[model samples]
Target: MARHIYVHNPFCARKCPYCDFYSVTDNFLCEEFYKAAIKETELIGSVITEDAGTNPLTDPDGKDTVYFGGGTPTVPDSRYICELLGAVRKAFNIASDAEITIEANPSSVTPEKLTEYRQAGFNRISLGVQSLDDEVLKTLGRLHDSKGAIEALKKISEAGFTNISSDLITGVPGETLDGIKRDIGTFKELGVKHISTYSLSIEEGTEFYRRYSGNIEDLVSPELERSMYHGTREYLQKLGYETYEISNSALPGYKSIHNSSYWNSCEYFAIGAGAHGFLNDLRYGHRDDVRAYIEEMNTVTYDTYKAFLEGNESFLKSLYVEERLTREDKMREVPFLRLRTTDGILLDEFKKVFGVEFEDVFADAVKTNLEKGLLERKERTLRLTRSGLDLANIVIEDFL
Candidate 1:
């Protein structure tokens, strides 16, 4: 049922102080991680074969999008990526137009590595160039300077990547509106098709949290952050990039297919440590620990797997169900996720998917938001108002 797959690479060259995502500086586990990923694909494929008659792709297009995401996918050997990709192809029906992407860091990617990735079927490269300002980059603890980030973008484009994306972090400690404009200008000049803007949030356990929690004023004030956010959004839109999602913009037709699958509630396969997927009325993922994941993948018995496939949830081993989704849970989640997109929640589409009218399920929240001018109905879509986008969390939570 899943038309997409995501593989998480947990090995980072060095963990950034601001990142809280599951990652380690250990490179020794890279080989073991890929092996377990391939093995996990095999096990998942075994289950899918029972349902798929002739092809693994359930989409009408007969294609699949495979994404290799952080903690810095480019840090590992390209051969490992190639082998795992080969295994994925064997397990799934990937058509020519399938959008395969790998997220890279400027500090980790090289021209040779980019070529191997392109040859191995990776058509999209998401380069993490968090800032174009040296001072801002330093404050964020990124290894690459502005020069390296620009060079990496050039190398990625040179390696025949037409659908390249670059990231920019707004609201950073030493960031300025001019700096944000400069970063956008650099990305635009480099022919980057997609740009994702992230707001700096100091989560607990990260170095940023330790440094700034006691004196939050060291970071941008709330009003300044808001100004930067709206300014960045408006500027990108003015530059012919559609703000397709809350924090994502793309030049025409360059939106991330794999990420869109998540927002649309389409099921996708998940592999490797910390990767998550939705399937068969459940959300499932392996433990975040690399060693734990490898051990579980290596030790699962045929009987247990068969039992697990048969719906005995207890038989689940290394990969455990995070949540058993109910029909009600799904109805609530649909609007919550869809509202993040520019298209918003399609009223007819909601009924088509859930067998009930959207208004009937969420009349109260919709009416409240509409009254508050936080929601607007454009044609058949219920999208966020300009004010609603700023207070998206509140409106989204109303649906949940």
Candidate 2:
């Protein structure tokens, strides 16, 4: 009954070396995985419907955002994707202006697939462009080159997708500021309204991590990263793109509703292998094993959803982990989460949720940061200034 839903597609045509997301390149498991996902969605809907008014988890207003993210959701056949989307619709009352999105890779997306997705009610398409420099793309282990990515963007736009997003990784090897400018220029030309920028980090368990474990600076120096970060912000703002989050920008009314919901600390239901969700004061996630997820959902009992709601550990012991949190934990987390956005925290909403004024709880922290010029206030909201965003870890730690 959550207002937002996140579906993690675990199939990928090929795994990127820098990606640590739970996904498999085994094409054979694709069909079974999606089928199990459909079955699971139906189970969730039925359980939510049964408990309708009585359950605290219920959100009778219906879902306004459904995000299909993953290891390249377009890797599988379009039929499976479409069928799964249909199952989601059948399971919930999607709002009339719902924003349904799909994450796609350039190498796997096709014109026909785009058409089908458009017809299937996927209003948004997020492309994994990674980098527009061919050498950088190769270094990142992405399957598509700059040319292929551009062509794919054109195809998505031609297929009538106006709400297009492109993901870019800054600080990548062989990337220059001029190259990024060219890429952004290309995106502007091709009608890309949203841009998600990420600084390449060598997370543990990734190929980049192994390759640059000791010499992380060789991958991307801190100074270079800072230059790119600020430069990207300035250029994007100049081009009329609003920097909504620390790493996301959108033109006018094109900001991502689904992603923004996360920044606001909204609870959502997460589906599929390795998907994580937060609801009713509990954070839960499925194991990263796709095969295990498929088997569990396919053989799941009708009481599975109810058990999940009740926190019956025995019912989900094999493939799920539920983290129980206290009221204080949720309260302390909301401000930090909301501060990630440009709009910052709404003081009245904060008080309504926690029954305490924002200043009463953390007046010292706010006063400290404000005195240091790392925080700013606009009428009824408080947010990080440009300096605070640069030193975010320092500012955010005080909240924690």
Candidate 2's residue-wise lDDT over 1-400, tens digit each? 3367889998888878888898888889988989989988888787765333222222223347899998789989999999989888778766668889999999999999999999999999999997889999989998899999999999999999999999999999778888888888889999999999999888889888888888766776788888998898888888888999999999998888888777666777778888888766677897888888888887888877678755665777434556787877877786678778888877877787678988788899999999999999888899999888888878888988
Best by TM-score: 1
Against the true structure, candidate 1 reaches a TM-score of: 0.95
Runs off by more than 4 Å, candidate 1: 50-63, 309-311
Q: How accurate is candidate 1 locally (lDDT)?
A: 0.85
Would you estimate the TM-scores of all the predictions?
0.95, 0.95
Per-residue lDDT over 61-127 for candidate 1, one digit per residue giving the tens place of the 0 to 100 score: 3357899997988999999998998888778866678889999999988889999999999999999
Candidate 1 residue pairs that clash = none
